[model samples]
Target: MTGSGFRERYLDVLASIYLYNEHRGYTSLDRVLDAVRQRCPDDAEFQAEIAKHRADEEKHYRMFRRWFERQGRMPLQVDSGVGHIDRFIQWVFRCSIEELDTSEIVGSEDDFERLCRVIMLTEQRGYAQVEIILKNRLIMSDPVMKRIFQIVHKDEPDHFLPYQRWLERQGRATAKWNERAADWCIHKILMLAKLPALFLDAGRPRLQRWPDEDDAITAH
Candidate 1:
C-alpha cells in the first residue's frame, strides 16, 4: 500500500474527468457536429472529420465509465467542480445547460469560427495533460491506467486537427480568435477549477471500505 493513497486519488481524478468529458461528449460535441452538418452541408470532408471526432469522444466516454466499473467504483461527481471547459462556456455564454442543448451557441459564421477556436484550445489542453499523465511513471505503472491514457492520447490530435484546419481555411482571423480562446480557457482552468481542486479536495479520494464497515480500509 505504499502508493495506495496517491493511486486512489489518481483514479478518482481520472474517473471524474472522464465522466465530465463524457457528459459533454454527448451534450456538446454531438451538438457541435449537428451544427457543422447544418452549416456545411456540402463539405463532405469536414462533415466526415466531425463525425469521426464525435464517435471518438463518445467511445472515450464509455471507455472511462467501463474503467470505473472495473475498479468497482462510480466516478466522483464533477457537476459542481472540475469540468473547467464546460464551466467556462456556461460563464462566458451565460447559458444554462438546458439552453445549450438546443440553442445555436454558434450563431452566424463568425461565431462558428470562434467556437472552433475554443474547441481547438480545449483539445490542445487535453492533449498536453494526457501526455503528462502518460509520461508519469507513478500513474502509468498501473496497466489499466496506462492503457486508457494511451487510447485517449491517440485521439487527442484528431480532436484538435479538424478545428485547426477549419480555422486555417479562414485565414488571419484564426490568430486573434485562437489567442483569445486559449487565454480564456487557461485562465478559467487554472484560476477557477484546478487551483481550487488542489486546495479544496474537489476530487480527492475517499478511504475505501465495504458497505456497513466500521472503518475505512486501504484501496488494496
Candidate 2:
C-alpha cells in the first residue's frame, strides 16, 4: 500500500477498537446506572439523572453499531475489559455524590473536592491521551470513524468541568493525603488496563474485498 493508504488502513483498525469500547457501553453503563441508583436509593433526582445518562449511552452504542456493522462483525463479548474501569469510575462518582449528600449536614467539602479531582482526572485528563491518537491521522482513518471521534472529542472538555465548579461552590478541592492513596492507585490500574485496547487489530489483512451495497441486498 502507498504510505497514505497504509496510514488510513492502520487508523481504521484503531477506530474499530475505539468503537468496540464505546459500544460496550450498553452493558457497562447498565451496571453503573444500577449501582449509582442503589447508592442514592431515595433521591429521585439522582435516579432521573442516571436514567438520562443511560439513554445517552444507549444512543452512543447504537451509533457505534451502525458504523461498525458496515465494516464487519462484532464479537458480542460480555466483558469488553473496560467494564472494570467503568465500574470503578462509577463507584468513585457514587462516593462523591454520597459524600455531597452528607456535606450539608457536617459542612465538610472534602468528598466533593475529591469527586471533582476524579472527574477532572478521568474526563479532562482523558483528552491528553485521545488527542495523541486522534491527531495521528494514521491511527483512525475511516470518514465515519473520523467524524465520530471529532464529535466526541469536541464535547469531552465540557463534560469534565462541572465537578470542579461543584467542588468550588461546596468549598472542597484540597487533597486529604492520608485517604487519597488507595483510590488513586485503583484508578491508575483501571486506566492502564483500558488504554491498551486502542492498539489492537492494527493492519490485519482483509480476508475479502469490501462488499457492495447491492451485494448485501442480493445475498439477503
lDDT of each: 0.67, 0.48
Q: For all candidates, what are the clash counts?
A: 0, 2
Best by TM-score: 1
Q: Which stretches of candidate 2 lie over 4 Å from their true place?
A: 1-56, 75-80, 87-116, 174-220
Candidate 2 global TM-score: 0.52
TM-score between model 1 and native: 0.78
Model 2 error, position 121 (Å): 2.0
| Model 1 residue 67 CA deviation in Å | 1.2
- Off by more than 4 A, model 1: 101-107, 175-220
Clash pairs (backbone) in predicted model 1: none
The stretch of ten residues in a row with the least summed lDDT in candidate 1 is 210-219
Model 2 lDDT-worst window of ten: 206-215
